[model samples]
Target: MDANHLINTLFPQGAEIDFDGEFFTGTGQVGDKIVAVLGTQGGVYIGVELAHRMAGIVLDTVRNHPGRPILLLVDTKGQRPSRRDELLGINGYMAHLAKCLDLARRQGHRTIGLVWSQAVSGGFLASSLLADECYALPDAEVRVMNLPAMSRVTKIPLERLEALSLDNPVFAPGVENYRRMGAIRDFWQGDLAACLATALDSPTGPDRRRAHGLEREGRLMAYKVAERVRHDPV
Candidate 1:
């Protein structure tokens, strides 16, 4: 009936489940439509696998429920940080998620994204990026790259990176920065109940990719990458 009860039913604490290796199912209704929330704050490998499972759920739901909308709650930190996951086709796992999202979209279901917390890199790409519409809590720490991790990977000193982030929001981490990047359309400024109400009330077919400036960002970057890919198809 309430959100807490709903969440508990979906994710009962002390329940033993292989979060990284299996599909967990919970059912609720979006108006007349039965909605399912798949996955957790688990790492990337599990997130990608969950995405595929979500897709399968969507297909089956559509067949049974006909035209109900699907809402996806995203709170991933990225793919699994494991050497084996990397070696054993991480790219393929991501592709599986992508294919599932495409299938959901083509079937005409209103696929929506709710980012409750950290949504970074490949995990974000696998789920939220494919949604028809997306929203995040105002306090949601959304980013393509976390600053510390980015600093380490980029080999930039943390202090200098922090200074650069003040001016370069792209490298900064926060909900507002994601808004600027066009990564998400709305922020949940109101309370959870109000926000969920708004989400249910809001029209789902809003032009997302273009409005978020992400399409432009990708188009501009596409040329540089395209040239290199054309030169070397590897």
Candidate 2:
């Protein structure tokens, strides 16, 4: 099915999915197996909500049934770039999401994030960052920033960025760069089921890239974040 069809199938318009305005949104079983759909348009509030709901689901599932894998599908431009979102304590909300993901890890729930389209900036951090494994579609236009936007924001000329993007996969926009960064595990090139199965089959542990040498690459901050998590379990 096409992307729109896929989204409609997953999150039907009439479905009574629970949502707390900007903080959380989802529809799934009460325990064990859970599937969440997060959009990119929402801001930090959405991230906060996503975390709150996931924690609730995890807690409920753990108290009742054996922990099951959580499937997450992400298609977002990024977190809300709004003054109100920042003023409403975005950092605290982000921290809450981090804590919820930590709970999932500590409890041994396989957290998998799938990027079907755009996964960027704070939106990526709020959800995708916490995954034990992450996968992106080959057609996904993923990136930290689009060239023109990056140029405008950084005050760098567009031609210079174009030059850099050609030589530096780090500056380009695509799924391949993230793979080189080790931030992504598998690229959904053909068979979606097989790719999902492989990601599900991955052994649980700290990402090696998160541990050593690769730190000096594009994901320097991610590396440092991983180290901090290692030093303190929480």
Candidate 3:
């Protein structure tokens, strides 16, 4: 969906959003509530500067907006893969951005992520995946890595990965696959304003993605394994 159309749909009361082609940050009204909005656009590659800038917005929202809910609009390719970024510690910057969002959640600001377009790899991880509840638009694309790339990284062979993806949503790349894995809480469709309102009014709770994964049968053992680890007498 076009960014402007999405903003208008979600914030029918109008918003004060600003988009500079790649990055956008602003505030929008959802009913009687105001939400802090921050996100990337056009499948931009997230680098040190972009990560730092996003983190600053989250931190500022926490400090200035008190308990206002935050909305993350994710659409990125991944971290910028370059020697300079590596030398500058791109991982640290991404982690900082994730931590800033975590801080906002802890500080009583409801954090919601909407995957309106593409969300891949570390870019998805540090943004949408960190939200209290992450939802995807009907046509959103979400993937950690493509099969050929995963094959190269894991040496699992493209054929084997392809066969695995048939039954295991974990090996697949799509909004449905992600929804099955519980990475995406749900899909937002129909009246978008209503969807946003409903999401905002939803109760906050502990992360349930693992449990959802089990129920959906996409990751049968993840929740059980996590439970075992949590109860381990180490």
| Number of colliding residue pairs in each model | 5, 4, 0
Give the whole-model CA lDDT for all candidates, comma-separated: 0.62, 0.62, 0.91
TM-scores vs. true structure, each candidate: 0.72, 0.71, 0.95
TM-score comparison, 1 vs 3, better candidate: 3
Candidate 2 to truth, TM:
0.71
Off by over 4 Å in 3: 152-160
- Model 1, 18-123: lDDT tens digits are 3333334455543344555554553334533455565676667667765556666656777666777677787687777767766767777667777765687787
- As a whole number from 0 to 100, the lDDT of residue 67 in candidate 3 is 95
Which ten-residue region of model 2 has the weakest summed lDDT?
24-33
Query: What order do candidates take by TM-score, descending?
Result: 3, 1, 2
- Report residue 69 deviation for candidate 2 (angstroms): 0.6
Clashing pairs in 2: 23-49, 24-49, 40-76, 43-80
| lDDT for position 32 in model 3 | 89
Write candidate 2's Cα lDDT for 196-222 as tens digits. Answer: 556667688876654332643645566
